[model samples]
Target: MNWNDLEKHFSSARLGRYRASCGGDEAKAATAYVNNMLLSEAMMPMLNVLEIALKNGIHRQLSTLYRRADWWEAWAGNPAFAWQTKEVVSAKAKLQRREETATTDKIVAELTFGFWSSLFNGSFQSVLWKDLRLVFPRCPKHQRQRHAISSALNQVRDLRNRVFHHEQLLWLTPSLLDLHTKGTEVIGWLDPKLVPWLARYDRLPASWDAFQPV
Candidate 1:
């Protein structure tokens, strides 16, 4: 959606005209602004998950990363890390990995695997490969396995974080409204009875209450 159209869909939401730096990266200011807004759409669910996790003793884990969550983070590779993972006290291993995220492919691989593994249980390969691997179809033959997933996940994470932070959604680009609407499925997960609110946000998909993240 164009800026005006985006403003129309989201009342009171405005694109940050003046460039605002995120993590001191001036080049990413504009995209970061729009992403900041769009990502908020994910918050209702992420926060719901946070609540569920909190009620189930997960909030204790958030205060200070001690387990897998804090174990394998790549500090400089992600901008939102500034906000989300900054509290994590790095150990010798991660600091070494941090030093290698860009230098050695092996380091990037392990760090990438660790990052997603922390997000979800079980092995990290499937989730990372499925969501991030295919993003760079044209990557050089060998580089595809190593760089593509990391690069795609990083870029997507930045955009996702921008939206998560509620900065701005539609900036000055084109987005698949169909895909955007699919977010209602997520709402369904949070509240199986939120069809009305989903419709209010124009996120209710055709199947409606049939499935979450529909």
Candidate 2:
């Protein structure tokens, strides 16, 4: 496609916005850079590991708090807790569709990243975080507030959804890279092994240089 046609697909107003932040008036360069970052094999695995760590990490904490592995049925299954029940049912449906044996770990693995991320939302914020805090052993040592972690996770969730939906992130450039870093750190807090594994193949460390203005 010609430059004008390409620009139409990406939108000139959006390109202008990126130019304000990134400098230069090269819409083609900006669009190419954004497309490259989107197509790169970095963020997806990081998000995958992140979602796994979140569900597993949170499941561990919840199990301890409720003193049972099947805590979801007791804690989330009720008329008063219908939202949580819906999330659980959705997770189970995913588990069943895959034709794999259903277990707590597998069910947690099948759960959407949104499910774990939503634990910090308005519905569960007041009570959930207290139990959830114990899993992030490093957070307290660094004196990082629970609310900060909640906000960071929510940010990752937003970024994850945007990327998966093929939306614009180039305008977010510097701050977008910061969110990727936050994602890895959050994964580390949950599972130390996952950090090194994710970093081994991660391209963002090098990929980010292209996003900065010359």
Candidate 3:
């Protein structure tokens, strides 16, 4: 299809960055636009595995620390965890709306990635970090500080959001690659065994190599 057709279908606003990136070469812009989508598609599996590893790791640790499966219940009752409690309430409501019983597993599945990442924020550093830090068993003792883990989680979270939102990722190729590495590193920290399993399915590297000269 021609540039006009592409613009009409994708919207000029959406194609603006592509157009600019390719120096006004309509063909290149269209190629880049399609390539951007491919890159985004390639990223999903890695992000999916990373998020699952993170949430499950934290949940397992917290459960052991509290000696209960629904350890978030303790947080919900504590005034200091007001923000996290609000998220738990929202997750439960979402499950209820779906007519699914709000079991601990269901509630955990319903919670957003944002909710899980926010637990690493400074507000809960004192209360949750001590227990949460143990979630990363493979991470070196000296490198397992709350702030470092928080930064890594936030970076992956941002990249995940951008991909899910269908934002432009062509220009972010280098940084996106870095975040992908960081994400996989975090997964390894959670469980070294998971890295090889995740690598078996990951496609971002090949996708990036294909989108050369961008």
Candidate 4:
């Protein structure tokens, strides 16, 4: 298609508004950006599965450590732990509005990745990490400390949010492939079998290869 036709879809405002330095033919650059987004979309299903796995895995681990399903709620009384309190409050509100009865498992599942990721924040690093760190077997294998694992999860979380929000992924640092690998690795830490299970349906590798300019 010619420039005008391309602009009809990949409008300069849409394409150039965020990423101003797009090189080569503007149309081709926009096409590449669109293709990258399509690839990003394809990775979502695998990412969704990964998100659930991480959530459940961490929930189970923490529950076992605390020996209580409502363990997160205990932090509510602590004035210094406001962030953790907010997450617990949010989860409780979600459960109260559910038409179906909310089981502990369902309530835990409903919590956002941000909530789980928050457990790794420096504020809880001393208390929470002692128990939570035990769940991350793959971290030790990779020579990653708790901070490293937290950093990786936060990066993947950022990428996941960007993809879902329709934000630009092409400009992400460390490359999307690297980010996806970190996500898959985090999944493997939780459940070794889940890695191959996700691999069976993951379209990221091939889609990414296709997006590379021929």
Candidate 5:
């Protein structure tokens, strides 16, 4: 299809960045648009593994620290963790709305990635980080601080949001590569064994390379 067909179907607003990036070359812009989608698709496995591992690692630590499988209940009762408590309540409510029993596992699965990542922010440092840090045992002691882990989690969370929302990633090729590396590193920090296992399915590198200018 030609540029007119592409723009009409995808909308000028959506394709604007691709057109600009391609120097007004309609063909190149169309190719870049499609390549952007391919790159987004390729990043999914890495994002999936990172999110699951991070959440499970956090859940494991919190459960052990609080001495209960449903450790979020402790947070719900604490005023300092009011915000996190709201997230937990919301997740449970969502599960109940689906007619699910809202079991601990169901509630955990219902929670958003944002909920898990938000736990690393400074606001929860005193209340959660003391024990939460154990989630990243594979990380070197020097680099295993709350701020560093928070930054990495937030960055990967943002990338995951963008990818899931079908946003343009062509303009962010370099940063996207860095985010991919950071995401995988976080996964390894959670469990070193997962890195080689994940490598077998990762495709973002090849997808990025395919769309390079030269």
Candidate 6:
């Protein structure tokens, strides 16, 4: 029970009430907004993905095979689709959510990760990479690592699994900056672009690569 082992960065965050501002700095604002959206933003999408999924999944779909009145359906019908917790209702609901969301996660990985990581060969973030590309389309391109990106996304999916499973994520050092990158740990796959996003809104330092992976 050593209190010294714990280092906390999250202050109490009210649901959706958490906010940061870049004031009048548009450059700063875009970067911050994207970073928050990627991590926390993914949660919202995960909910829609699950909801739409529960309505549309094949084996588990709310069609002729299963209806909204079934126990499995009741399980999926719970309200806490995005939250991870120990309450029986939420835990069961989350499992249902993941069962549906995992497939789409795979789809996103295939579409974005390799192309995304190629933008950061020697350490730059997608935050700047994406915008910079938009600003400077002729910039030399980085080769895509299809397998690596796919693999990374798989890891990220596992993190998703843990959250939906309602397991204690206290040990998790999470940064929701990328929906496509993955590795053994979360930060290892974070894009530098996330830093600019964080900086834009949260006023973090320029060194986003410093966020160590656990």
For this target, which candidate reaches the highest lDDT against the unseen true structure? 3
Per-residue alpha-carbon lDDT of model 3 for 115-175, expressed as tens digits? 8989889988888899999889899888799899989898888899999999988677546
Off by over 4 Å in 2: 1-40, 76-80, 97-101, 122-126, 141-144, 191-197, 211-214
Q: Write the per-residue lDDT of candidate 1 for residues 153-194, one digit (tens) a residue.
A: 344344445555454443323232332433333334324455
True lDDT of residue 105, candidate 3 = 81
Which tens-of-lDDT digit does each residue in 1-214 have in candidate 2? 6546656887777555555554555665566546545544457878878877777788988888778886788855466567777888887887678877778877777677777776776566676777887767666465455667778788888988877866556556446678888888888777678788888888776666754433
lDDT of each: 0.38, 0.72, 0.87, 0.75, 0.86, 0.33
User: Which candidate should be chosen as best, given TM-score against the real structure?
Assistant: 3
Model 6 TM-score, all chains together: 0.23
Report lDDT (Cα) of residue 11, candidate 4: 73
Cα deviation of 178 in candidate 5 (Å)? Answer: 1.4
Which scores higher on TM-score, 1 or 5?
5
Better candidate number, 2 or 5, judged by TM-score: 5
How does candidate 1 score on lDDT? 0.38
Compared with the true structure, the alpha-carbon lDDT of candidate 3 equals 0.87
Each prediction's number of clashing residue pairs = 17, 0, 0, 0, 0, 10
Which 10 consecutive positions of candidate 5 have the poorest summed lDDT?
205-214
**Error in Å for residue 129 of model 2:** 2.7
- TM-score against native, each model: 0.27, 0.75, 0.94, 0.85, 0.93, 0.23
TM-score of predicted structure 1: 0.27
TM-score of 5: 0.93
Select the stronger candidate by TM-score from 2 and 4.
4
- What RMSD, rounded to one decimal, does every model reach? 14.9, 3.7, 1.5, 2.8, 1.6, 17.0
Clashing pairs for model 4 are none
Candidate 2 positional error at 149, Å: 1.8
Sort every candidate by TM-score, greatest first.
3, 5, 4, 2, 1, 6
Q: 1-214, model 6: which lDDT tens digit per residue?
A: 1111211222223111222233444444334434443343334343333223222222232223334323233334444321211233344455566774423334232222223233233343422333323322222244223344334445555655554643322224554333322221223122334323333343112223322222
